[model samples]
Target: MSKLSLAETAELSMLLEVSANIKPGNIDRFHDYEDTKFRHFLASAVLARDVFERVPQMTLGEAMYAAVEHTNGHTGGNTHFGAFILLLPLIKGKGIAGACEAVLRTTVEDAVRFYQAFGKTQVRVNREDEMDVNDPASITMLREKQMTMLDVMRYSSETDMVAREWTNGFALTRKAADILKEKDGADQIQEMFLRLMAAYPDTFIAKKFGYARAVSVMERAQLVRAGGLSLSRFDEECILGGVNPGSLADICIAGIFTALLEGWQWDC
Candidate 1:
């Protein structure tokens, strides 16, 4: 855990590379991509049973349980150590723990990249002169509220500065969630999507399904809110089936909550 394996390092490296080139409009797309990647990883884990069949002493369940618990902050709960023992054979050629670490580390990198990219897009700085003001000392003062276009105009800043000013202080995660929580959040989130579909009206269409599937999950878990949203049921099913949740942001938020609940303190 102290030394990230090659795969883990590669995943983090990819994240850092993407962070440098992030743009405002790419945030959502990036999140969607990460979510897909994570789901794929989980699926792979569940489907690798054949590879472990030859290892008589290895236990896949124990290994997977350990990986999930370690991530979920349930430290020392080797309840399923047998599964990991079973998985030992699959990773035998590549060090079972190392491979598992790599997969988990990749998830961590995706989480970082998703948020960092969002943060980068929110802030912009165009001119050389504005570079001086981009210092952490100055930026910290602005990370509070939404920097509006009008506010940028008043500052006489460069186009980049205006963009940066508008987003420099933006908190993408909270803002995205808030956007959903607000009176028109869902409509707004769905609106852009609808508009896009309208523009391509002749595209392949699917039957419209109500939120019935989602609602059922919320109801069974007693997580329904008068106004709040819950994916508890969906998430539970996904977890049991080794599937990813609806979005990267959702997965990241789940990790955060798990970490928080398990008292795993981090600077974040």
Candidate 2:
């Protein structure tokens, strides 16, 4: 009785049709197919879920849409296979019923939109053509360019109190703090941050996302002797002074791990 999200259900229905034994438009053979055919289809469907998750920028919805748009194209075939891999994890975590529905709903909408774009009547057709949306190289380009949505999502979902404190310490704007609150917001900010980091890896962006700062003997003494360095101290001395984040990796690491240790879990 695991609850399924709206998206997961949509994916499954398309999967059933896509993996069928009978050819397209062959209604009778498809209908009369043995129960075993369906059972196996169910199994393959599970595999597809796992595939979707591992794909870099593509979420289940994006991948499913890609599948419907270009099922015959090389990219579409990649998505088809990717969908199978995504199914396993979804099934184990969410029950079969819920997951299937999400999958079906997501995929069906994409199927319709794909047909409408070309002035064609929407059907359960697999076009498999080469569209920019279906480009297999999109994933590679994202990674090489360091602009992955997956990474954005992960950073957004995984960021915690310590990370927040760190950002606040850096004197991030109030809007920036709010942006870090949820996954979508975090993803948006992270995307921008990634670009900043790529351009200025030796600066603030890299420090926040990638590294830590070390406690100096004098800095440690201040903590022990005068109640630790406040984030304000770090902000005034570092942020305003334009000190690079790489120089503070140790401190950042300590703070991040401390926050994680305080108990954080991956987003659902």
lDDT of each: 0.28, 0.30
Displacement of residue 12 (Cα, Å) in model 1 is: 6.4
lDDT for each residue of candidate 1 in 1-268, tens digit (9 for 90 to 100): 3654323322232232123121111222132243333333333333333333333343332333334333222221111121222223224324323333433322322222222222222122223434134344333333333332224222432322112212233122223323333332122343222122122111011101123432343243333233243334423443443321122222122222222222332222
lDDT of 2 at 230: 46
| lDDT of each residue in 154-228, candidate 2, tens digit only | 232222221222223322212222333333311233222222222222222232333232223223323433545
Can you give the lDDT of residue 54 in candidate 2?
40
TM-score of each: 0.19, 0.19
Give me the candidate number with maximum lDDT: 2
Weakest 10 consecutive residues of candidate 2 by summed lDDT: 23-32
